[model samples]
Target chain A: MVSYVETTALRSPAMWFTANRLTTGLLLVILLILPFVAPRYWIYFAGLLGINIIATHGLNIMMGYTGLLSLGHAAFIGVGAYTAALAQIHLGLPFWIAIPLAGVMAAVIGVGFGLPSLRIRGLYLVIATLAAQFILNFVFVHWQSVTNGDVGLTVQPATIFGVSLNNETRIYYLILFAVVFMTWFVVNVIRSRVGRALIAVRERDLTAQVLGVEIVKYKLIAFALGSFYAGVAGGLLAYFNRFVNPEQFGLLLSVFFLSAVIVGGMGSTLGAILGAVFMTLLPELLREGALQVGDTFGFDIALILVPLRETVFGLLMVSFLILEPRGLAQLWKRAKQKFERR
Target chain B: MNFFIEYSIVGIASGGIYALIALGIIVIFKSSKTFNFAMGEMMMLSAYFFYAATVTYSLGLVAGFCVALAGSIAIALLIERVAIRPMLGRPFIAVVMVTFGIGSIIRGVVGMVWGPNDLQIPAILSRSPVMLGDIFIPGKTARAFAIAVVIVVGLIAYLRYSRAGVALRAAAADAITAYSMGIDVRRIIAFTWIIAAITGCISGVLMANVNTLTPHLGMVALNVLAVVILGGMNSIGGVLIAGFIIGWLEAVTGLMLGTEYREITPYILALMVLLVRPTGLFGTKEIERI
Candidate 1:
């Protein structure tokens, strides 16, 4: 009897590039033309989306890839924000230098918080991160001399050869480049030896340790790298918003980023991007719909709008967890497979 | 010296409320092995129900309390059936996120029903000062503290001796064994949620009396997180002691450094406890084979 075995192209680089490059090139072209084609409001929205994509990528590295859940992620972003603000205001450093400095500062703080992870895992680690969130937020509010005591600090725009990248359009381009770089960097990292080790630690730390993976080292690296991304995102946020306040980095925002990571797809880079876009756009769409409904029904939109948005946001998160735990990425893969089969 | 004594009494009284809130969290954890992050929201929602009953419907204090208790129980059961039951065997983070999502929904609904402003619920306790020997305690605080103590002690006794309570404990300890012994584990879980809602309702009313009712009332649950951690997740009696310690510490810190510092003391203490003893003061140490 003769048996036939189907040959898999999983190990072929040609197949991978041919499949990915077209979509990648198309996305890049769209992002590049978004400023001109999209309205001013959307350009501003795109900038904010870019910033969130960066922060979500950082969180995805920690929670999605490395299996370390951090509820204090916003605190790390805040750290980067304040660091960049201080660096620019006090040190008079340019945006180029200050942003990287912001990331480094956040990475250091991330390592400090990550130390507790060595001693604890799961729920305890989450609590430890929560402590970091509250404590750092406390510092932001009370440290009047540095943080301006809840009034927050105003940030200057990025400049190249003394031309201010101040407006939404210009900042959109800056954010666009940063997002592309960070996304590429994250994709490469996920394919590297360090990324594999991090994934190994995530799958089963004990087994990974038994197999000679330095669980401690990989865990800390994940925290540092994740926070570094958050910090850079924060720095960009400061310049983009032209302001940084304690409220912007609150616990709710941390939860927002976590939800984005979960909704995107935990371990995939494409998932991070999709999740950020969906979460950011969901609220705006809800608000617009609420306003239209209120106008038509002759009821007050002001009171119900915020609460309605929150309700929908939460409902989506719950339904996503229940109905699609693998998130949009899984759905995307399924669709792709169907198309390919056809 | 007089001020110190007064603050201590106030702090301990507030701690009683914290202990009550922590008790709800511990009960849910014990029965289902799922930490209900929405406990604070549950407490806040119950308080809002009381506000709606007494203020909106003019039901008076006694009727309002009953309405609030029933409302919280219904909400808790609804959440258990809709959100939690579907997520029974999911990962720890997923369950936690689901609860967080449920919390967000509750917060939004409360805000929509009752605007964002703080509304005063009809005061259940008196306002006159109580002379406790040399130091005078606020009447409302003293009365609320007494009520909290009675409830805590009563719950302790109920759990210690009651047959249903024993069955609940058995289910918590070993669900498979409890199931084989003819105990309905699912019913016990539902019962635990009811107990949690009851505790949350009482404490929510007490808390609203102490502080005004607002959507942000749920933020107090963050403080309870510290108490839950310090006492240990699985330890019932330990939470009481931990609650008192946290309350006292918050009062002292607030006195010394101001209100800003008071907000963070529990988290700092929780972090310290996590660093020193991750299992908490009374948590059972699990020996994992894998």
Candidate 2:
């Protein structure tokens, strides 16, 4: 019957730290043994889910926390992916250096786009970010010398200390490490003064400004930081896939990420994690479910499931918006409250 | 010079279609203040409906056109009633997300019904070229251009003169006040959606005839988005002009630069226009009170 706050804030720091350490250690052990326990295919999905989680976290910061809606978020991801790929291929930078460089590049672009939020907001900003997506996509497609255009660039395996992280298992471990570190950082950020400023800005910009919060500074920081996460996730994705293509980073992907933030519960870190996992597995789950139904009914439902899945996905967004505007995070909170009452 | 004129005409033809698409988007925005991201999907769906009527059902062109237009109208009404009506007091972004979802649903439905591959909806108009004193125009383009102009003019006149149009405009201006004045704001909103759907159908049919029909045809909405941004989101007549200007810009860019420039030019132009005048050339500037 413990309240949500009593369950967390009431706990002693030493006890909390011990619990955190135990959880972290257990998570690390589980991740290490996951490849041995689960199949290779699930491992790939897990890596992808991890990448989505990272990107969604950043998106949550911008859209969820700061109330800046970006329709071209995937462009930053592209910037990160391309930067890492190009850095590794042309400059021959190591994975460690290239990944951070990707984040920096995407952060730069994110800040550039964020500058307009100072002048415009609401729907105008959405269009502005959409413009960023299209422009960046155009560049990715046409800048043949750098991006290699439509043919796409095949990423070489990343290495560290003469050990190539070539296999999916190694990439999975790397993603796991990245996800844990990023999640920790994001959680810390949310609990910080800056995080409070971000929430204040999202709730009311005028009020936040009146309270001496530099709206522009915080907005730009949110964008840059969010995009940094996206860029890093993009780098991880590029390495894991061993390929980078302009086609992969489209407006649809941006919409998917935005949807994930919404579905998970905007502004909550846990919601981002949950949403990414749910959305990433959705199509696969739908396909399997459709196959089962097809087998049961003696009909080939698989042929139509792609469109059906899309329709259902759209329905989910609409229903969620109307029925659960606060998203799964809010739902989880409600469930926890019920449990506490019980 | 002749080549320039010809491409310009081609551009105008395509621009007219873009205007039609933008008209639908603007109409929806004017009434509800909701940007229907699904406008492109509506266009795509209506085009598929037209194809189904004419090709799949083997209906004649006249009957097929009616069925197609009617189907689009029905879909628009259904969407407004189901998804949009429930979203009245929601945040702007959430509503935008709903439209995005609607778009996905439409795309999925189209994919399921028609399959993912491109289907050629046979050109309803004659395929012969028209001679206009040293300029040659394709038959379908000429027909589409004419249809677009007629519809634009017709809609303008209707809005300026019709009782329903005046009520709709009033509702758009102040929904609460209009409701108090005994104007059925809800009906007006629904009518506006119908107009949007009609425009979607016309543009869809024209575009399908001009190009091969595919699930991705809705992506062209992005191009028309530049047109709407250029024309101003609320300015109906301005959208037409902006559409033509952008169409010409695309053509000129394609000629001077390369084929790739055509695809990206609209977005670049949209950005430039937005940075210079965020309200767009003819759009009403939204004033904020502190």
Per-residue CA lDDT of model 2 for A1-342, tens digit only, reads: 111112132222223335569776887798889999999988988999999999999999988888778888899999999999999889999999999999999999877765754456667667778888988999999899889999889999888778899998888888998998898888878677888888777777788889999887888889889999999999998898999999989987897888888888777777788789888988898899989988998997867987887887887788877777667777876797799799
TM-scores vs. true structure, each candidate:
0.95, 0.93
What pairs collide in candidate 1?
Answer: none
Encode model 2's per-residue lDDT on B99-213: one tens digit a residue. 9889998998898888888899967778898889979998888888888978987887887789988897898889999999999989988999999999999989888998889
Off by over 4 Å in 1: A1-18, B287-290
Q: After superposition, how far is residue A166 of candidate 2 from its true place, in Å?
A: 1.4
TM-score of chain B of 2: 0.96
Instruction: Tell me what TM-score chain A of model 2 achieves.
Output: 0.91
- The 0-to-1 C-alpha lDDT of every candidate, in the order given, reads 0.86, 0.85
**Local accuracy of candidate 1 as per-residue lDDT tens digits, B35-93:** 88899999999999999899899997899899999999999999999998888766677
lDDT of 1: 0.86
Interface DockQ per candidate: 0.45, 0.45
Q: Which ten residues in a row have the lowest lDDT in candidate 1 chain A?
A: A1-10
- Give the native contact fraction of candidate 1: 0.56
Model 1: number of clashes?
0
Runs in model 2 lying further than 4 Å from the true structure: A1-29, A295-305, B287-290
